[model samples]
Target: MAEKKYKKIVLAYSGGLDTSVLIPWLKETYGCEVIAVSGDVGQGTELDGLEEKALKTGASKLYIEDLKKEFVEEYIIPTVKAGAAYENYLLGTSFARPLIAKRIVEIAKKEGADAICHGCTGKGNDQVRFELAIKAFAPQMDVIAPWRFWELNSREKEIAYAEAHNIPLKITKETNYSKDKNLWHLSHEGLDLEDPANEAPVNKPGFLELGVSPEQAPDQPAYVTIHFEKGVPTSVNGEAMDCETVIQTLNKLGGENGCGLLDVVENRLVGMKSRGVYETPGGTILYKAHEKLEEITLDKETQHYKQQLALKFAELVYNGQWYTPLRKAMSAFVDSTQETVTGDVKLKLYKGNIIPASVTSPYSLYSSEMATFDEDDCYEQGDSAGFISLFGLPIKVRAMNDEALAEKTGTHFPSVE
Candidate 1:
């Protein structure tokens, strides 16, 4: 292979197996100074000893930036408010990648790096997300995807390469699950989850990180009230907490109640189906609460339309189109709809069940007098005759045409009956 004359490269490092190996590989391959950047999006203690590890491996400098508050307030909150879930999978990993890539690009520019590198495999969705985010921010910078260029095809191969180069790693042959975690969620893939026929080891003790299984949850149900102000969760169980603390508190409560566990076989951006288990305890609660609040506050048309927009929003987030114009436009619409979505939602969590107990909002469009069965001054029962006739006119005309055709042809034609 011919040598490239790149001076410096910025890597979106996680201090994980793939990134740990990438530090040395990039230096050896391109002879560039590697600057490792690890964004802290509520991965908790996972950032510990990361700087030393990156430097010890091969990186010239390591940047562990605190991105938790920004991630929650900017990315996670808007996504939750937009109700963006990709095929019922909470976009925990999807949304975090763009932010991480954006930060890496920032660091790359600051260091005057020639290229940016990421640990995302060629076959996975993160590659697309990271690349798209990078392109959005810095289109001229070269992207070095080592997974595409390197001969390390599998975990075993990568481990072999690491061992041969005297590079230390945490992964071993016994490690089955490939996991990604942040403040919003923890995702598990590979291993037993790779097979569609295999059931998730939810019954196992250590299978879950954010929460416990429904069976392992307490027998009694847990009730909690969530308050929302303009679609953002302000308080949980009447306690006002910051973005970080609120999510953490709800993660504990929702996990104990067996909430926010999902098993999905989703179509990946790479055109393959992948199965994974996601634990999003706090996110689940917020989703349910936001939905309930919207139910009462938003009018029928806006509420229904926003529900449709949410699917697209989910797709954009999942595909890493976070910085695109369409996402921004959709978020504007979502924010407009959320202006009146201030309210409280009461829910009962039991054995992984999120049961809506009650929902109340001062801006609620629901009127008791309008929908009552009893005689009321607000609504007249006799008005329904004209309203029904006007509403059913298209169907009535079609049925009439069918009847005339049947009579004329001396054959039975399908009617609206």
Candidate 2:
């Protein structure tokens, strides 16, 4: 069959090994012009020289977008407010993918591209995220997933293909971890992490980027005061900051105090289990503080039900169902519950421990006057008898019925003694 042809394709390029090789591969394989697009979701210096590199590697052009603020405000904040954590692993990578992919789709539409491309593997959740976003926004655009169709299967093969094609590469076959970094978190998969039983070598010099290991952290704890308004973090250490500044500040403080490191073997959306390690120093602090604030502000029933909603939200995000109606509905519910969650939570961060020092909110349901051991006139001491009797009526009736049955049958009931 004749090779498939595309006039123009917008590639979600990271200037990484796969994407670098993809530029020329797409040009050659599909006979199309490739425009590489990279989202700056706060990978820091890793994005440097990406444009020149992409152009040098045969991309017609490169669009490097700064999405840090939008990512935090629109994506990270909602996930945080919902307290969405997939099996104790914060949805850092999961949360960022949809935004990045959405950007890619927008660029594709603006560039009049026939298709959008991504470096996501078939087995990973990112492919679902990228394609779903594309389908959501631009249903007419085709998706070119190279890993799905390409002959190169291993890092070794990719390196050889890159060398043969003279593609510039900073990634090598021996690259230890398959990582995805954004303002929200840094995730490490592959390498030693592929084995569930193998302990992550956190002691290794280059293993961690966002924070230190708990053992290497300082013995002295660090105290931070976080202020939230309607469930969104507004300040850290009593100083008001924008979303970027707040996250950056907290990342530094929490990293120093050994916060936000997680390792887990998770069930992938593709019906496989994968092991990964994540560093989310700032996110951990924000989540802990927000949770504390909710404790003081939210009523018991709302808190309990919201906890259940949070689990579903986490699953939706992790499964790449961000644009779905169910997630939006859940977010609405989460937002409504956050109205009274405005407050300040003081936390003691010590060696990976996020201990709540104090929580205060104007809407706090806790009443010291009513809860105190030293009695006040408002307390009705005699009300307990009726409450207990009514509450235990079922048990009392069951016991009496059992006794009556035993007497009628002339047989001893087990509990009669």
Give the Å error, residue 331, model 2. Answer: 1.4
What's every prediction's RMSD, in angstroms? 1.4, 2.1
Query: Best candidate per TM-score, number?
Result: 1
Question: Candidate 1 on 27-143: residue-level lDDT in tens?
Answer: 878787999999999898788889888899989999988999999998999999999899999899999999999999999999999999888898899999999999999999999
lDDT of 2 by residue, 157-201 (tens): 888989998887766667647888888789999876888889998
Report the CA-based lDDT of candidate 2 relative to the real structure.
0.88
lDDT of 1 at 76: 93
TM-score of each: 0.97, 0.95
Pairing residues by index, what is the TM-score of model 1?
0.97
Leading candidate by lDDT: 1
Give me the runs in candidate 2 sitting further than 4 Å from their true place.
Answer: 1-3, 405-417
Q: Clashing residue pairs, candidate 1?
A: none
> Which ten contiguous residues of candidate 2 have the minimum total lDDT?
168-177
- Candidate 2: the clashing residue pairs are none
